[model samples]
Target chain A: MKEHVHHLKDEEVNILLNDLLEQYGYDFTDYSFASVKRRLQRVYINDRFPSFAEFRYRVIRDSTYLTYLMEQITVNVTEMFRDPAFFQALRKQVLPVLATYPFIRIWHAGCSTGEEVYSMAILLQEMNLLHKSVIYATDINESVLEKARKGIFPLAYMQQYSQNYLQSGGQHDFSRYYAANYEYAKFSESLSEKIIFAAHNLVTDRSFNEFQLIICRNVLIYFNKDLQDKVLHLFSESLEQLGFLALGAKETLRFTTVAPLFKPLAQKEKIWRKIAT
Target chain B: MTVSLPRTLVIGGSAGSLDVLLQLLPSLDPACRLAIIIVLHRKSDNETLLSDLLATRSVLPVKEAEEKDLLRPGMVYVAPADYHLLIEPDGTLTLDYSEKVHYSRPSIDVTFSAAAEVFKERLACLLLSGANTDGADGLQMVQAMGGVTAVQDPGEAEVAFMPRHAMTVMQVDRVLKQKEMAEWVMSL
Candidate 1:
């Protein structure tokens, strides 16, 4: 039966998700079914579930499997300074305006694994803006949030991340930001102090604070058009007039309802500035 | 058995596939109903260049697949360099920044597996030239899902590792030369 899950119908998937939503409070019906189904297939195959029906039964009956499903659904593929050019553009184009504000609030929505949040903190520290800034990094997964709070990453990844830092215009040695132990590198305590890691579901949560810059890279691509529009609306509401919005390289506002409300500040980098109403 | 025509055509390739693509893309039927998706290994910084180059090959309106773009018939969608292109259940194209599989973003396996799940038997996938075994497992998945599967003949491929690997691992439906592959796609 597990071998046949690749042919699972959208109706079947909807039934499973709807049941999960009814039993648990988590909702995923709004996500694009193709991507969600792809993730679900991985979970089913990896955990050796007999069928989608069995998987759904476990999802409704057991809390641990539900948590595992949530982790799978959220794409946590992130790296420190994943795109150096985007960070370079952020420093050169977005930071100057953010510098003028007495106190800045930046929301890192869907900040999976906290790599980019730490990247931003390092950037702020270099620019001497760390004291005046507060970053609220949020994701729906609590386990990942716990990992983010710990501020430790695999030591093997540090070499590549250091190169990304240099390309992104680092002012000093990238090694200075972390203390490398045996297999993991624990980021400086000061860098971790400025970031508040929490669970914030983009699907259900309301905007908590008006931010000067909202960095939600790569997360919106996982959502459907309606969800993308809803999340964009939330960002618009949560941002100050003329606040900046940054997205992943492939993500754009071209097809969304909120495209008209923001002007491109850096088009290729997918940065936009809110237009004052 | 009469072959049920596919609604989508996916082309997966890697290091050596570009040249074969340049050779094959121009011959695609402009009126074909299949939505063509191309997943090739490429650098993230080489944005728009691949699409621009492929655009010159055909009248099929070649462009990088954008997030949430509806899959239109006769249009050629190349996976954007850095993001995995997925087919949503509604037949719309969605881009993902998920972790790289087989050390490559926009992985052929990721896209092919997702497209196979969505399109099922209504999908046809072709494995082209490359140096790695990336698309072999994906084509196997496609075949397992009862979709049509083809591979570029190893002898004809510039670098045969990709197609050769597929041939060794999976029972693909066709092992055609570049020109024959073009003709086959046009016939579809």
Candidate 2:
């Protein structure tokens, strides 16, 4: 006999997700619905729960499942120098503006596993500005935050990143940035010295400090318009006068509430500078 | 007489997929009864025109799967850009904005494993051309659930690591060219 498959309705899934998030205080209510629905579906199927209601009950009762759910919700798929051209643009345009400042505070928001944060630190070190720079690298995921703090990456992925680094106009041997032992590459403490990796949720958390530059690449796409606006406003408030903002190559400030507050530094690279108001 | 069971066809791929999908779509059996779900690795920000592009070539109705859309036979569903797409037990679609698996929001693993959980032995998983081995673990999970698994021949793939990795990790049911893969899906 042919067996029929049952499907959950969108309204039901939304209610379940909202309940779980609100009870858990994760604030996924503002994230893009399409994206959040898929993740929760995975959790539901993986656990062999018959329905989203069952899964939500399990989530409410089980602490470990809640942790797993949190990990599943906070996608942290970042790579070292994932987009070389963006880094190159940073070197060409933003660095010059940053050079004029006596001291700099840079924020790498949604800094999944700290790859971009380290990339920024290394760039600062080579430019002889590391001493004057303080980088706050943050993500909503604590597991990724711990990994970011450790500064270790698979040795195999380093060669590709090194290639990207060279193409982005690296001044020194990329190997100098890390020490390879066994299968892991531990980045130098000198680079780590300038960085503070922490847990922060852009959706729910408040802005920590005013920054000279905030590089939040590949993070905002997950957010819906309302949340994106709220986060952009937070960035606007957290950024000093004429401070710079860098987004993912595809992300833009054009449609958001804070759009009028920033002037494009390099439109193609998705880099913008805050306008003094 | 009992009606034939509806099958779930899961396709996972990454880099250089547009070319692969273009080639693979025309060979599919339009009359086949299975629901085809495609997981293509893509940037989260760009609008996906894949369904429109593939719809032109396929006899099956092609659309980017929306949240809560029921999975139906004779229709093709593509995962929307940047969002992981999974099937609910009742066959509706669920999108996940959760942290990326293997650095991808719409991770192949997320979808494949989710389908494997719901469909169990009725699922058919396929790995096509891609740069990373993102779908290997998911294929394994599908196989563990007694679902059928297929991999595109690395020799024929635009990027081979994805299928090649799946082949290395588990014994898949078939390694076929895109046309043969289409035929295999029809046979199931």
Candidate 3:
């Protein structure tokens, strides 16, 4: 076995990644170095290139490789009713606060492939809030946003999701949410009627609307501390006074500057209520 | 001359893997012919220093697996925190949005099961210390596909549930302490 040195230095990797993003308008420059490096290494290995320089050259010279790399780096891995306990907690703890509002604007940040966004829409519809709520589902990856807009997923995955929906206190049959044809399940367009799916980079993009509830789950963990702080601030700015902030079960704002600005609604589920200014 | 087919090793662990990886990797024989792929549950947003940290300890080339990278002998590939890492039949790496298994994106079961399907008899699946029983069924599937199965002895694991569950569900070929397991894998 041969020892390979830290061949791909952070600065070099950043320059290459930033160049690609700048040229292509895909803004992964603010993503954590670990993430950028891991993805780059994958691209490097797949293309059978021995060094980052070779990979960088190919990425710049070949548009096809660049597109393939973009797809590889941006595909969002998500599931319906992911973290069932969080959804259950939202139903039990946060829905009451949401119910008080006659109209609601909610943002599902980094809502990859629309699972959590659809999940929230389903929950809000059950509570009679969908008619009154508008959802803005945003992701940095256009490919994933496109999928989220389509609201379709593999039918083979539906059985497990059905169990998760029931466990999370879903009111209707899980099948009612979608129409299955062959291997694909297309969610009812009515469910996404209020949803506006768009490409928004947390690194380069600013908040578009004031939201009563901002749910950004499992997405923040890919960022570095500085990037995380920037995103948290974005969420804070996007949220309304005394609004709700929900994170994935494993994610928390306790260590950041944002912790002081929000009070915990359910600490275990990482549900927070923004401090009233 | 016909080139021998390369063997691939898939590992899954969580909670206390840093110490285990540190211990096990240094002891691995440099001449080992298999490519090791590891899934260590980590914070999705935090910087993973595992490759840098492990590269210093192991003689084998250590890297984070990338999409469509062909598997090479004596290389160690770590899965990125928030991505599902799967193996292609041609030994290349592929990333997918395939729904989370065991409540995790970079899940042990997802990689292990996918590798089992792709690599079949040339695969070796190992279950290590983890807080949950995420990889037991995947390891069983690997064994069912004629791949080798190994589990860390529960008493020696940092978190015993994962290896213990694997032991209960499947007849793993070996249950060794960390160092012994490393030696056993190299000998294979």
Candidate 4:
């Protein structure tokens, strides 16, 4: 299954990226080429394209196929409370500021399938801030956004997520947040009320609103340095003064154009606070 | 077959593998110009301080990888837990939080395959003591990419299942003795 499709040459990858941009206004040319090439090869095998030419032909000719292409080209791996320490830091360090605000606005950029959005909602509810908070969850892929809207996830994963919740200082019965429906757990509608899931492309779209807390985790590593700088600048612009920005465990704002504008709130956890002009 | 000497050495392990590394790391010659990467299955908690532990014994510097860091020679790198480490074509390191392969993030398969793709024949891989079969297919990919492959001899492995299982799926170039690993590494 690994090598059913021969390795994608550099020129072929450029061609595919160019085709996607020309036809759909989806610009992936700035994505990390090595990661993109690896994903492209996997897409070829999973979609059962007999050859690279066939894959390219279908992408150029069939708009419907582009949907699958879009979904496959981007990595969508996420989990609830993925790094508990980061969430714990949010509970201890960031939420107090949110509590001070009469109304809190949070953004989950590149929220894949909404796991972290739901996680954030749960966190706010624990702090008695859910009723006052509005969470805007956005992703580049519409399919994942659709899933995020449903508020259902695999029941088996709840155990792991529950552990994460406990580790993050959650006191309530973690099971209280969701009801198990056969193989899936459906989160309560109250949690979903605060969240608005939409498809927003970081590569192409401008900042839609100012956020007091913006969380984009493990999403920027796919991009090139230039694109990362552009997106980090966008995040800087989208933030309110002293807004909290939480990234993945290994991600950071250091060495980016926005570095001077933000200071680490929880340095080890990669949470940064926007500094004013 | 006398192929080009490999410049990158990626070692993968889980379960009882750390003991082997403690034994093997001290024996590595700093003069051997291979960029050594160690991938271990571990909890997200930093309680183990695995890199720090390895650094105490290694003749070379050992540190956890940060995103976009270049792979420099004569150094040791440990993959940060809960993320897959991928080597890009330009020899820069990148991290991915993709789905776990073999019920483990930082899966040996992810790093070995990505390094194989980039380093090709300039890569050499060693699979060590682990309870699961995570490193077998990765070893296979390394061999497929013309990289040298070695697995600890099941007899010498702390948990033989990993090496035994690896040997079943892939044709490795060497069945490494526990004490001779550093020597075998130097020979490359």
TM-score of each: 0.94, 0.66, 0.63, 0.94
Runs of candidate 3 exceeding 4 Å displacement: A1-12, A25-29, A47-54, A61-67, B1-188
- Per-residue accuracy of model 2 over B64-152 as CA lDDT, tens digit each: 88665678888889887777776655666766555678988689998997888678898998888888979988888788778999888
DockQ of 4: 0.45
Relative to the real complex, the DockQ score for model 1 comes to: 0.62
Give me the displacement of residue A177 in model 4, in angstroms: 1.9
A57, model 2: CA deviation in Å?
Answer: 3.3
Best by DockQ: 1
- lDDT-based ranking: 4, 1, 2, 3
Query: Residue A110's C-alpha lDDT in candidate 3?
Result: 86
Tens digit of lDDT per residue, candidate 4, span A1-277? 4552366767888898899999889999888877787788777767777678988999999988888778888889888987788899999999988999999999999998999999999999989999999999999999889889999999999999999999988888899999999999999999999999998999999999999999999899988889999998889899999998988777888888889998888888899999963
- Model 1 misses residue A177 by how many Å? 0.2
For model 2, residues A145-242, the per-residue Cα lDDT tens digits are: 88899999999999989988988888678999999999999999999988988888897889889998999986776676678789999999999999
Model 3 C-alpha RMSD to native: 12.1
Q: For model 3, how does the per-residue alpha-carbon lDDT over A73-111 read when each residue is reduced to its tens digit?
A: 754667898767789998988887889998889999989
lDDT of 3 at B153: 85
Task: Kindly report the root-mean-square deviation of model 2 from the true structure over all alpha carbons.
Answer: 8.0
Docking class of 2: incorrect
Return the top candidate by lDDT.
4
